[model samples]
Target: MDAVAARSGVHRTTVYRRWGDVGGLLADVLDAASDDDWQPPDTGSLEGDLAALNQEIQTAMAAQPPIMAALIAASFRSEKAADAQQRLWEDRYARCEIVVSRAVRRGDIPPRTDARRLLIAATAPLYHQLVLLRTPHDPQLPGHAARTAVLAAAAGAFAEPEPPSADDT
Candidate 1:
């Protein structure tokens, strides 16, 4: 708390009052960290967008591995951290959803495609390398992640389940 207070030039009491504890502080930090130079790209194709997003992820992970690592670790044990992490991801997925919806409209991918799932699958590898394996970052990972998602979508991997018919209910 002192470190955060010193860095932000705020009093420790104010920080504690606002955040209540380290979990809240961590949550706030993680939420703020979500802001970056990347926006989901519109390259006239789903593949391009995913690739762009992946590249951005790789760049961010490389630049702030420790912050990412700390957030991921805290998420497992803190409700505040977990909610913040989930919200951050939800916001990211919402942006990526635009690209998926565009692809659906263009007939490039199937209708009712699960955009959130697709985005998660696409970036899973980079997160694995960053938080779990703790391995060196790879710049090409974004392109590969995008390609894999495109392929999976083409194969109907992220297709949404059909809603129940009226008679079935």
Candidate 2:
């Protein structure tokens, strides 16, 4: 709080009064991010769109000071921050669902595709490499992961499984 106040040129007391604590402050920051009008890239094709989105995620994960990583870690320690972070994640996933929807409309992937699963498969590689393994950045990673996911999705790997028919029981 002191550092934030100093950086923002606000008094420490004022910052404390406004946010109450670090968890509150983190939650507010995450909520503000969720309120942004950011949308996934629309590149006409599912592979292109997923590649572009992966690039964005890679850049964010590799940014200096690693604010995204910090927030993710901090969320684990604070209930408020965790809730806010989950909201932010849900908001992003919901927004990105359009990519899958667009692909379905264009006949690029099967109907009733599991958008969330496909998206996570496409984006998880970057997170695993950069955030988990802390591996050096590879320029080919974004496109490679995107291509793999697109292929899997097109093969109906992410299609929603049909429920059992009445006769099965």
Candidate 3:
């Protein structure tokens, strides 16, 4: 209560009066802490596609583990953190859904493509190294490894089918 009031330059009584208690203030802040960067590359080539998307995902998470970690720790004590985290994760994956759907419509990706898995596959090796395996999230290593794994998985996986000309099927 005191900490929240101090941070916000408000009286503790004011915060308590508005939110009801210290837990309420914590819950609101946790709900509001978001680390989202919603932009995907539209490079003409799939290789560019893999690189751009993974970079956004991998770098953003690595750069802000503290907020995520803090929220997770607080979630053990507050439902607000859990609800907010779930919502944020869904929104992040929704961006992947858009990428996959657009690629399928344009014949740039296979009809049976799994955008969610594809996004994860691109990131797995990097995370295995930097997180699971406890190696540093070496900017160079993750960037290179992510691009390579995704492109390798995608090679011949989704070649564009021959399109008919205006005159022919």
Best TM-score among the predictions, by candidate number? 2
**Candidate with the greatest lDDT versus the true structure:** 2
Residue 59, candidate 3: Cα error in Å is 3.7
RMSD per prediction, one decimal?
4.0, 3.9, 6.8
User: What digit string (tens of lDDT, one per residue) describes model 3 on residues 59-133?
Assistant: 655664344345445656766656765666555666665666676677765665666676666666764665457
User: Per-residue CA lDDT of candidate 1, range 1-169, in tens?
Assistant: 6767887899999999999977798878767867765468889988988888888777766663356566667788888988998888888888778889899899988888888888898989888877788777666778888899899998999997995366842
Candidate 2 per-residue C-alpha lDDT over 65-144 given as tens digits, one digit per residue, 9 for 90 to 100:
67788777878888898888889888998999999999999999998888999999999988889878988989999999
Better of 1 and 2 by lDDT: 2
Q: Model 3 reaches what TM-score against the true structure?
A: 0.57
lDDT of 2: 0.89
Worst 10 residues of 3 by lDDT: 64-73
TM-score of each: 0.79, 0.88, 0.57
Candidate 1 TM-score versus the reference: 0.79
Q: Is candidate 1 or candidate 3 better by TM-score?
A: 1
Cα error, residue 145 of model 2, in Å, equals 1.4
